[model samples]
Every structure is written in C-alpha cells, then in structure tokens.
Target: MDDNLIFAVIGAGNTGQAMAGYLKLKGFAVRLYDRSEWRFKSLRKHSMRLSDEIVSSQKIDLLTTNLNEAVHGANFIIVSTSTTAHIEIAKRLSEILTNDQTILLHPGRTGGALIFKKILRENRPDLKITIGEFESSIFTTRVSATGSTVHYYGIKNGVHFSTLPAVDVRKIFQILKIYFLKLRPIRMCSTLL
Candidate 1:
C-alpha cells in the first residue's frame, strides 16, 4: 500500500508479469520491461490479466524494450530475467542507474548479487546503489501461452534476501515488508571464498 514507491520490473516473463501485477494490485506504480518486443505482442493496452490465487487485471504504467526508460526514476528495479542474463543486464544497468536506486534480483540463483555488484563496480565505480537478491522468486507463477494472462500461484514464505554492503538491510526491509511480510534478511558473508 505504499503510494510513493515506483517499481520497474526488468523482464516480461511469467514472474515479471506476476510481480508487476501484484505490485500494481497493492497500489504501487509499476513499469514492465523486456528486451524482446515479440513477447509483448499479445498484451492488449499494456494490461495484464492475472488468474489463479490472485485475480486482477492491471494496467502497467509503462511497457517498453528501452532499458533506460524503464530504469529512469524507478525506486526499485526488480530483475526477474533469467540468471544467465544477469551479467549483461548488470552491465547495461550500470550505464543508466542513478544514485540511491535499489536493484533486487527476484531469484539470484547462485552468487547473482555478487556478480552483478562486481560488474557495476567495474562499469561504473562511482554509482551508489543498493543491490540485493532473493534465494528464489517470491511468487510461483506461470504465464499463459498467449502471453496475455498470468497464472498467479501463492507466494512462497521464508524467502531469504540480503544486500551487497549489508548495511542497508533494515531500511530496505522496512520498505519490502509492506509487500512481502514473510521475507527474511540474511547477512551476505564477505569472507566466504
């Protein structure tokens, strides 16, 4: 129910649509982005219909293939793309991301945050941003073959998340709790080689 937070979902797959629709359902402004325009051909008027556990038709604020347009002014950049795309996306994001923007990987898979953080540093060392990742996606969702509908499965509980610097966990957690009540903060160990 946060009225001020604007989210940019970076992907148009099942999870991305679910996250965007769910966030919009909760009364937040959301923009959906994808690299492929073909994926969006079936969507009508930039609206997504969610079925199953949660049912709602949400109109995304913006839908585009332009990464810069999607990232601009977004408070939270939610990366729902495949793990394999993380590196390249991180590289592109480093070019346009501004200070104080937070990036959250829906499911980092393995060492996703670390790799992304490293790439951002290498690409834009002075960029100040908080980057974090979940052990897995929060929602279990599936998009229909036509790409117009998303089957909303129940949210998974006990999802662990942590930020790169580990200093802003409390602040980020406060904002996240409104959306995900069951999220847990885990300390990212820097010493682990």
Candidate 2:
C-alpha cells in the first residue's frame, strides 16, 4: 500500500478492530469509526494489540464516532458493519462521500454492493465513487474482552469480491491486494449473491 493511501474502518466490532489494528501495524494511516464512543473506551491508550496470525501493537491514527470525521480524506473506506446496516450506512454515506472515493463492504453478503450503490445513486446522483464488496470477510478474527487486543485466527486466502460496475475491480483490487494479498475478483458478483 502506498504511504499516502488513507484507510478508514467504519465499525468498531471484532473485524473492524482487527482490520484497523492490522493496517496500523502495516504502517498505513488508519482511522477507526463507530456509532458509539463507548466501544472505544476499552482500548488502552488508543493502542491495539493484534496477535495470532499476525502480531503487532500500534496506535491507530484516529478514532471517532463522527462518520464524516472518520472518512474525511480517506481514499478507501471499509464498511465492516452488519449486512442489515448496509442501507442506513449507505444513506449516511451518500451525504458524506466525495468524488472518487472507494468503498468496500467487508463480506457484503449477497447483493450488497448493488444495494449499496443503488442507495448511493438514489440519494446522491451526482456522487462519483466505486462500491465493492467481498463475498466473505477477509479476516477470521476476534477481539479480546478488554478491547485492547485482537486475536486474528486467520486471514482468508483467495477471497472473491467484485465492484458494482465490475470494471473497476482490477483497479481497486490492485491497491487492496497490497493489504490483502489473497483477494480475487469475480466477473459476476450477482451470480454469487
């Protein structure tokens, strides 16, 4: 990943923490966001410890409950929330997203990218962005009780994913693959959905 590439993980659950921690450890500037600030209270001094598959302790660049603040200037945004929350998040993002920003839903479930793009287009027709989703989460991880530690059971290999328009898959995958090496692009995303 380029040092200039900024990443934001929007969800403070297990996968979100692991991804944020892992990215921070890898030297990418990472901003972590959640709807609730209470979720971040357990993180010791804003630092997270990642163990198991990968081991590292690093301080995330930013932690905020403000969605706009979390994604401000972020080149890539990772929506790690539940599939059920996709529509709401998409509505919220329609208000905040800027042109050319890329969004990737971690394990978009089935038609996730399409649903998200539809919401974006419906809400903000002028917005120019790429939406994509993983068929499944890339991380098989869990967070410790204190919230200060993340146990990464494994990083999935050859994870399949696709973008809403399909054509942007290769371009987006090029940057994403630097962080998640096993990412594979599928030609037809709806077929999997």
Which residue runs of candidate 1 sit more than 4 Å off their true CA positions? none
Clashes of 1: 0
Error of 1 at 135 (Å): 0.6
Candidate 2 local Cα displacement, residue 125, angstroms: 0.8
Residues 1-193 of candidate 2 have per-residue lDDT tens digits of 4778899999999988988888887788999999988878977365688889898888888889999999989998999999888889989999999999999898786677888878988889998898888988889999988787899999899999888677888888888787778889876645543
* Cα lDDT listed for each candidate: 0.88, 0.86
Q: With candidate 2 superimposed using the best TM-score fit, by how many Å does residue 184's alpha carbon deviate from the native?
A: 0.9
True-structure lDDT of candidate 1: 0.88
Lowest summed lDDT across 10 adjacent residues in model 1 is found at 38-47
